[model samples]
Target: MEDNYLTMDLLRFTTAGSVDDGKSTLIGRLLYDSKSIFEDQMEAIEKASKQKGEENVNLALLTDGLRAEREQGITIDVAYRYFATPKRKFIIADTPGHIEYTRNMVTGASTANLAIILVDARNGIVEQTRRHSFIASLLGIDHIVYCVNKMDLVNYSQQTFSSIKEELKTFSSKLRTKDISFIPISALKGDNVVNRGKNMEWYEGSTLLHTLENIHIASDRNLIDCRFPVQYVIRPQNDKFHDYRGYAGRIEGGVFKKGDQVMVLPSGFSSKIKSIDTFNGEIEEAYSPMSVALTLEDDIDISRGDMIVRKNNSPSPEQNIDVMLCWLSTTPLQPGGKYAIKHTSKDARCMIKNILYKVDINTLHRIEEDKKIEANDIARVSLRITQPLFIDSYSSNKATGSIIIIDEATNNTVGAGMII
Candidate 1:
């Protein structure tokens, strides 16, 4: 049972929607209906719900952990929850809905494989819905499941759900994501979320949990271009293992096998994989998101920030790159300011070469005249790095194509960028 649990694949998903769109309630329903909540947790939420003068148990209290969030009945920060079913494991990032907290949504959704966007059946499509959808596409999330929630309030009308679905279809046609789906649900009444509620016999589709368990995510990884950035060099000097030299890191792309011909970046030295080592022993092969130490046949000069790739399929070394940057700091981005840059395992200094344009996320238009980038602003900018980086386009491989900017004085991450 333990082995089966460990081997079960995980799916990380984020929930986004307008205020009161039932993002938290939907996740809480999943946890409660799946029997993931403990007795003590259920008791606590039940007590709190009574104190708040609710008629019934408030399931949203399961995720709204902060005191401010509970007091205000709003999610102020990103609340993460974990649960599992027999088929798969799950991580849920319940992000804030306010436009001011858009950066929180980006932080939570950066590594997600899918996004669950809620839409209130009564209100239909709105601004926040479009904003979150655009950001999900920008982050390259492949699958989007829009839950048309609160069907009970709308009398579970098929026409209401159909109208919202049509509007979403028309708006999402402009999005880059291809695999989009819709499900009518009543999170408060426990309908069409975990079980196929009888109230929705008119609708024919899998439940949200069923969709999450069976979605095809294995093909989403970049398997053609091999990218392995060296995070650390392991050298254990002892009598039993005196000659142990291994380059350790997480594989960013493609599959690496024993005896595969690999090239070290920057130095351009060539070698073959001697072994792939893990705590469980040597593995025959490794792929993206797997952490392992690799022993090479040749004793090349390799260190952190160096990347190992297939000789025939290597990322180009770049010094000047264009990126879509999301500014996260309070201080506005300076035109020619210099900042520390961290990309994959490589660290370097970069300067803002130019600001091409800012994006009005709601309208999805390029604002060429508004060049000043403030907090929560997304813009296209050019950066000149001190060292050449091995990079692929963000659309091609997210692992090798994202960067973070740190403020030199405070040592805080101020911005995130996606390579164009």
Candidate 2:
């Protein structure tokens, strides 16, 4: 909400691909052509490129900001990059392409409105492509742009591009991805990147940057089930107003208004919404994704970790939860392991009750036997929380529907879970 450029409609997207698929180059091209690159940054990359004795500038270096990444010339960690175009402000999560870093892709894609899955045009769809697509589907990413990169190597042949696109359509159809688009691009040579390419006149779609800025992402929030997790209680006894009690937090789902009957979860205390307050003054209404505080007509003991919702639209409060977890720590996720489960503004201890299955990403097969889930591995597991959790399926709402497992001692996020 700061001084954003004209393109203030923020677009959060994640890029994913196999090694050498040119994901980084495509991102760098976007940032460069948009003139989001500063003179100093460009000069630094130019200097580094000359030091490496490269014939041309290594555009990928713009996103690979890690020192170890530069030395090895491979991305081993997720790098977040920000850039803006005249039509939109964008955040790109440049995740690693290696199969070992599947967890990184999930972490990056979890909050993404769209995902760009790149493929080498010459290679077609490979195992890694299938894996990335599957994970994207599992994480509920709505949009996918398949960039068939390295088109220069393929002679920019429309036949080659169409053939690869056909194969991709056939393979990706088996996944649960809701929407997908295809583009032929040479991230290194800049064909069909930021502008239309004369060589590929047969392709009629807009450039990657245009598509990103114009995508229909306005209808992504859940405005049906009202959820407000209390983050703080504001009680100020000022001279003008002796008694002021307000429960403040961000709305995770649905809408709220004055006179709407609300229920306090975990306690099941029913109350009528008296007024919704904001810094500007009392607002008549509020909805999902907005931060506001509410004052009930009759205070019935609402506190932090308590959720306010429409009585009939409230999510289930349960202790036993089934989740799909991606292991993130070096320590393996063992059965019966205990960790702190944090969901929304609530936190409690939970134990891994059972290992349901480990998904073979490429095959979409559930392996019931192999349960040795280590770092970067994803498995469906059951957990028992010390207290009740207010959750909806991850497919419905992303905020109240997901949780993270934190190590009690180190406080490291060891795993992320999507409630099933």
lDDT of 1: 0.91
**Shift of residue 418 alpha carbon in model 1, Å:** 0.6
Best by lDDT: 1
- The TM-score measured for candidate 2 stands at 0.94
Cα lDDT tens digits for candidate 1, 1-420:
456777679999999988798877888899999999999999999999999999979998998756474546442367778999988999988787876666778887798999999999999988888889999999999999999999999999999999999999999999989999999999998898999878989999889999999999999999888999999999988888699899999999999999999999989999999999998999999998899999999989899999999999999999999999999888899889999999999999999999999999888999999899988899999999999999999999998999999999899888999999
Q: Which of the numbered candidates is closest to the native, going by highest TM-score? A: 1
lDDT of residue 34 for candidate 1? 93
Candidate 2: clashing pairs of residues: 7-87, 7-88
All candidates: TM-score? 0.96, 0.94
- Count of backbone clashes for each model? 0, 2
Model 2 alpha-carbon miss at residue 55, Å: 3.1
**Which regions of candidate 1 are displaced past 4 Å?**
1-3, 69-76
